[model samples]
Target chain A: MGEQLRKTPYHDLHVRNGGKMVPFAGWSMPVQFRNGILHEHRKVRGSAGVFDVSHMGRIYFRGPGAVAFVNYLITNNLERIGRGRLLYGALCNHDGGIIDDVTVYHLGDEILMVVNAANADAVWKWASELKPGDVEMVDATSDLAQIALQGPQAESCLAAPFDAAVKDVGYYGYAHVSWEGAQILISRNGYTGEDGFEIYVPTQLAVPLWETLFRWGSAAQLEPVGLGARDSLRMEVNYALYGNELNTDVSPLEAGLRWVVKLKKGDFVGREALLAQKKAGLRRTLVGFEVAGKRLPRHGHPIRSGAEEIGVVTSGGYCPSLDRGMGMGFVPPELAEIGTPLAIDARGALLEAKVVERPFYRKGSVKR
Target chain B: MEFPERLRYTKEHEWVRVEGDEVVFGITDFAQDQLGDIVYIELPEPGASLQRMDAFGSVEAVKTVTDLYAPVSCEVVAVNEALTDDPARVNNSPYGDGWMVRAKLGDAAQLDELLSAEAYQKLVAELGG
Candidate 1:
């Protein structure tokens, strides 16, 4: 396979623990463990699970004008965010299309932006061009590694290695903790829509911290999960993925993420286009659909109304928790209402479906 | 992977067993493991005619969809309707209840082209599964 690509700190450990390895985002990552996807996914929903997210990109912007430069690039209002707080926002292009959905952290004078691994280079280049005189943009992706501890028992599991104060870290808020003489950034945010902590540390020190957490949190029923479970977990909560749900051709407003776009926060990239589109009304909108039968619609499947094809499915899979097939796709704005009957043409056969609310399953520990 | 010694195998990972002139077909354990959790299976009609190595149907797992190929030249005689409601049977019992179809053999000579269990096991091992 193309030299097998780069590996994370737990690569060897994953293989030893019966993990099925697959190439994802140019990295050799685990797809599933010995317990399988269903067991691992339910484990995270009921208890806690650790994930190796080292492939995610970490970019740092420093200097005096870092805040101003970032404000001009992203669609969210950074002035409202305080230090140690995380903001879920989107980086859009000049045409109002989403470049990438990211989490921005205000780290005092500097800003730390976490992006999807597959869109790292694209986001870096886009942000680099916006860097003016004072701001210095550095791609700190290779210098750092990230791990996520997610589920209902996440807080107690993380409290062992860190401090009891880690429990008080509010949702979307983060704190810098000193573990094994290394300063790691721990944020109470995750894509699984569960109460979790995404910890960022130096690349070399990742293995030690992983081992410590796995060893100490073993009693808490924390299993080392892989990407297969991760995808199902996020899909269960209807979280958007980079290539599947969001892309350069789809705008944040069209994807139902208008809450992240702050039009009143002065001028920013894609602001005018978004404002104009908001005034004119959106032509197409993304909606969640549940397959009415046993047949599951796949990505690139044609969505139809009667016999006329209208849209295409962007992401689809069988939701284990929901015990049905679920997917996200962009249909005509008139047909975007909840409970709208739709059909997905799976090859030559038509599978009955209905457009429901965003999340297909909602019994997660996200707010807890 | 568990390759039953009495079963015949295809290069595409389909397994078949001949009972009189009728043959039962399903994916092997190696195929099921590689596909992850199977969510759906689209089977052909009972009266459909199949050619050797032709697409008979498809199996949908969580992240992938694999096209099922006919193991031998035969006329489809029966389809396992149990898979319509419970596709997970493919993961639970790939060789038994998960059998996709039963077909009456048109050419018995086509059965000899399939791999023996020992040969199939060696092929799976060589493929790094």
Candidate 2:
């Protein structure tokens, strides 16, 4: 709208590779390439695909109080996250509703938080406003560009250019490495529910590094993926997208992220509210649905139990892996059973669907 | 954005080809490209009556869902049921196997109001080269 706003470091590279650029998270990002989203999505599921996730926000909390500050801000138990380890967590409002879902990296004395790009400024401001003594919050989002190489062949593909030791980096773990004279943080973490590494390097070095990865990973069948594939991949895994499954109104507990909320971890921002909710029990929780018919349920589509509206779809799409219409949405706890029948009000028509378990396609290398 | 010279197009990007009274209908190549991947398509039921420019079906991609509009009023005689399992055919062959529906046109005069290949190309170009 406003001249289409900003572009990532790989903007020109995307265009050259026949990527269709679209506005997302306030940045111009490639949605798909010449082969299309289905091809890109299958590429990641079958072999390997590299995604330019540079639009995600990266913030560094440094100094002696870094650990304490992060422990106080997020709901996850930071003390349990050892050095070089990463933990998925959430920044919550006082009401226990999520401000943003984030991944925290315990980098020794410092803590690095990666948040949704759209919530970058909001997260930074919230953390700064809470500015407890001795902690320094720095917005490192612009300085870094993230590349995610995900799939079964991800390790072998990334190991070529990166340190051979990277192969041993366990899931949700990271290691600092020197690549082409630049410091890079390589994390064995991804949202695609696959074995992969999220490499964070200097923005100026993004294009060259991307090219090197593509060239070396070619034999491994690593393709340059776009955001469209990334979304479908995550959706298939039932990972919550910020605006979709998570928003100002949805709590981590309601979104099936209760494992991330540490009730025993002394104190945190939203501890009191979550503790209260835990006692009262969740009214509506996120659940997966697979449409029985060809009609796909979409965001804002109402979920019904006969004549009553039980819930609404937060994220829905046709999963290429399953060859079915799948979605994640909030539903009454009573209707969240694995095989419960539900109807999706897709516009004026009612589409038949059934509740299903999370990670709809589980033949992934996520834990492997 | 290939609009075949022999085909007539709608503003919503559907292409209709006349073969006697039966008209073959499919989305234009431009529509397929813009939609990215066709993951699911809800085709109109056989013998269903449709109005000109009305939504006859819908297509779902990974991130978005779009309604497929009728180019002209007709009765759906056939639907591509193969799309239920392999909807990517729309991307692979929008004009051939990806043809969505075959309908008997209610009025052949409506074809005159559709866009020509040159006109559709010009419209797409003006929207953005």
* Winning model by lDDT: 1
Q: Write the per-residue lDDT of candidate 1 for residues A1-368, one digit (tens) a residue.
A: 55667788778988998899998888889999987888888889888999999888899999999988888888999998889788988999999998999989999899999998888889989988878889998888888889999988888887676766687799989999887788999999998978999999898898888888888788776888999989988887878888887999999998878889999999999999999999999989989999877678788999999989999998888888888898989998999999999999988879899999877787788873
> What interface RMSD does every candidate have?
1.4, 1.6
Q: How close is candidate 2 to the true structure, as a TM-score?
A: 0.95
Per-candidate TM-scores read 0.94, 0.95
DockQ of each: 0.64, 0.75
- Candidates in order have lDDT scores of 0.89, 0.88
Name the TM-score of chain A in model 1: 0.97
Best by TM-score: 2
Quality class of the docking in candidate 1, CAPRI style:
medium
lDDT of 2 by residue, A262-367 (tens): 9898889988999999999999999999998777888899999999998999988788899888888899898899999999998888989899888898999887
Contacts from the true interface found in each model, as a fraction, amount to 0.56, 0.94
Compute the lDDT of residue A12 as modeled in candidate 2: 90
